[model samples]
Target: MSTKELINNIDSFVSTDVWSPLDPYKDEKIIFQKGDGAYIWDINGKRYVDFINGKGSILLGHNDSDINQLLIESISNKSSTVTGPHQYIVALSEIILRDLKRDHYKIAYFSTGTEAVKASVNMVRMASKKSIILSSGYHGWDPLWYHDNGPHELNKNDILDVFFVPDLLKRAITNNKGNIAAFVISPDYVYLSEKTYNELFSICREHEIYIICDDVKQGYRYRSGNSLEMVGERADLYVFAKGLSNGNRLSCVVGPEQVMEFSRDFTYTSYYELLPYISALGTLKKMRNQNGYMQIRNIGATFLNNLREILKNSPIDMNVNGNGNLFQFVFPNDEIEEKFYRLCLLNGLLFFNGDNQCPNLAITNEVYDFVLKVITQVIEQLSSNYNTGSFSINDERRFISAWRQMDGASDFIDTSDRLIIINKLFSE
Candidate 1:
């Protein structure tokens, strides 16, 4: 069938797909036909360089040869989901632990990121015996701590509602002063992080709070280990996904053995076992190949440097944010950013941020070059538009005020909407 037919026949995979929502990220509406190394073709046969990477899951690209072969072998064995230990799973788990360099990186398999997340949350909360879960919205959706403080931004995903970071979670953790459950955080700054992680970890440690780092988005493509590598092996719980199976349905939460033991008491689950093996084998093999890490990091560095060159040459104000395989290119004004998003779409690039404020993980040398070139063209065209004059700090502040009212921040908030405030001063 054509890409259109594929979209028409989509399973939607929402309520039935492990905590997935009906139309999360609004991507369900887009028709995708086939995916190659770093590009996906729509039913219309219009190939677009994919930056989403299944939301950064497919680090090695869609349908990688190695992963696909393992998948076929695993599927043929009819051992997709089993009750007992399997060589594939054990190998995977062992490889995963070994790769993370946590001699005690004891892992329990989960079918999806959400399950991994839920399991991690329960483990930490139980171990810590606290209820506060501090984190950005990237962690799988589950009941650990309430994201009710409201400053977090809500986006409609094709499968579920996503509460993203823009709000400060630590403020609440500090203010509440109750025994906190787990402090979950993304290593990257995309979610309300101003490199406050060092202090945040220190505070959580001081309070005896379990510091849970969600390395889902930045798992493999960027660093040697997930950004959690910097945190040392001491975190009470750390969850990893994406790049594990080269993008297959695999995720694991590694924590102190005692903390992970908390999962023994509660047995809620949704994931299949095959994915664990797939993730383990794929990640292990890739890492052992040795050059994978430097290849991705170098590719990413090249891509970033090119972006900086583009921004320097462009008349528009733009900057790249975050780092390594998971960075986002930020434009000066939301309108231009939004316009560039559409423009990128027109140029056959699938940018994630519809608002143009954030475009992440272009992936691969060719795709990255294509995306940078397109961005260069867009900036050149928009730069000459006097009406598109670079936005200033004051202008950004005004935009934030208006955006807050428009986004319903006037009504409620969870942590301080500091991202909104901080983003305002970050101009072109």
Candidate 2:
């Protein structure tokens, strides 16, 4: 189909908001209607290597035998819920709890990541006996008490009293002191290890502050059992979602029984009837049976490191930054970024723009190697033509001025300053 037609079709569904016709995606809409393994097919039936990985949920690849079989079995068995018990539910939760070996942690099956997140914060507040929270996280939107994400632009529910840095905790403590309830951070996929995880955990521990680690996007990327096991003794509550079920809607909350289980004061209830429970259960089983994490994670790491080698001399400052098996790319600037994107499109390679979210995965050895070759080729092509960098200081000022003109941002972000930050982070 023509670009105009694609744009029209998308506009029909999303006239406004993020997916609206005014967005950048309006021009790039591929309208992929089908996917299998690492390839997704657009409306015009063009197949591309899906690096976006259904925004990181397609790690098992489009339709794997195991996930597909379990999904079909779920339909075949019909759905069930509880205040009662089911064997598969018991078994799945057991696997999660068992592998992690945290006797105090309890697992719940949620319909979405944000749902799990909302539930977690509510629990933390209930146990902390405090009103405010200090967070260094990109948790999902829920109205609690937000101090970041720039105020009301994302809605009050999504905002919770969150602090983006540990220093903020210091500043807040002087003013608010014991009033602060919790400190939340994503130990994985969190920007700059120098700043976030280890230090935040230590501070939270020292202060006796509640630590909530949001691992929604990074969990199960490499390890199945409590993905932030590396957080190392500071988190009072832990949350994970992204890799829990590939594309299946499954998220989990597990932490110290001392804090999480005490949230009985607040109501945390889901209908508890979801087919994805079985999907998640079966996923754990399959991973167990195949030793999936061990095999696939090693494969993924090797693949990523090889790409880094290929791009070693490229003028564009690209960094392959991630842990275990998760994948993401950072680019120098907008012009180079646009060029990288076009090259991927022409060769049918896929990757996200900003965070690159989670790069999709190949479940099998053969599929992984084939696509890795294509990606290697694409990187080589991009490297040869690499013209370096996005968002000039002037452009940053324009965006700021435009937003300010249209009322204003609740959060204070110096765009000119951020330009420097982004550049420094991407530089090897």
Candidate 3:
């Protein structure tokens, strides 16, 4: 079908245009047809290097052969989902525990990262007998920690108190001491300084608060051995999803037996469909054998280092954020950045979502070289325009603020209700 036909069909059945705001151009959205390795093809047969990488879930690349083979083999063998329990689930749990280098922790499964977060919230509140939660970063759309408060802020009466710095955490804990059950955080992709993390660890421990590490985004990419290890601390409960199964719909919570036992009666998801578990087993096995984590880090570092070197002599002010696995480009001005995005797209590169690049293990030298060439070309054009004073900002439509935590353009745009805020800011 044509793009218009596909849009019409979708509009007929789809109730919500939930992803409308993520369109970089704020115009037509491309319908992806297929993905292989580090690239994807849209319905129009146009190909683009998939730097978003399934929003950081496709760590091994799209349609990875080993994972696909496992799924195919399982489906062919009629691996039916049993109602009560399954060996594959147990095996996935075992692999998680083994890879995380933790023993004596029980594991529970769910179908999505949000479900896993919900489960973590339930587990902590029950275990600690507290009703309040303190959180930082995005922990999925579960109502426990998130409130629909006009996009920029959380509800004032929310049971969850969010903080960006360690001092705020300390203050919040002091103000709501006995009611706070857990401190939830996700720093696998974002920046959480070691000092701040240690303080969070120290404060939570002193107050008898459980620290829930929401590792849904970082999980396997951060490392097979506990993501918290990189920050020099561990949490009471770690919720994992995304890259765990390389695009499989599976998530799990791993914690001590005492903490996880509260979830015995809380098990409420039919995620034991078996296919995702099998995929998880295969993906984890392959990641271990190949040291995929280090490989991704190396790839990201190499790309960023080369990018820095290439732009060193250029007049454009640029900076890079994130670690070796996931990073974003920061341009000197919003106009330049916007034009750069358009130029990249016009030149057959999909530099959308503000140049956030999440490289997977499949990013070969050739693939990265192509990416570098595109970027260099764009940068050269941007530099020429900058020198000539020809670059003009056209549209200022920004990405939705809710996607700020995951999106790279977040730094360049406001997260609040823009219209309301602008009206309020400059009211005559």
Q: Assess each prediction's global lDDT (C-alpha) against the native.
A: 0.58, 0.59, 0.72
Q: Roughly what TM-score does model 2 have, to 2 decimal places?
A: 0.78
Model 3 error, position 200 (Å): 1.5
Highest lDDT scorer: 3
lDDT of 1: 0.58
Q: Could you estimate the TM-score for every candidate?
A: 0.76, 0.78, 0.86
Best by TM-score: 3
Q: List the pairs of residues colliding in candidate 3.
A: none
- The digit string of per-residue lDDT tens for model 1 on 302-411 reads 87887887677666666665445456555555677667666677787776662112122225677677777887877777777645454743434433433321221221
Ranked by lDDT, top first: 3, 2, 1
| Off by more than 4 A, model 1 | 1-29, 77-81, 103-105, 143-146, 149-175, 189-195, 231-234, 265-272, 354-364, 384-386, 393-428
Question: In candidate 1, residue 382 scores what lDDT?
Answer: 73
lDDT by residue (tens digit), candidate 3, 239-259: 888878888788889898988
Candidate with more favorable, higher lDDT: 2 or 3: 3
Cα RMSD (Å) per model? 6.7, 6.6, 5.0
- Worst 10-residue stretch by lDDT in candidate 2? 402-411
**What tens-digit string does per-residue lDDT give for candidate 2 at 1-428?**
67667668666777545442112344566566788876878777887776667557666677777788877776777655545446766776777677667666776556677877767877777777776665554565554534334431222443333234455456655666676677766544323344345665676677787777676766666667655665454356667777767687778777777666755543234435555677676666666676766676677677667777766755545666554356555555555555666666666766565444344445455655665677566667766664343222343433333221111211234434543433333352
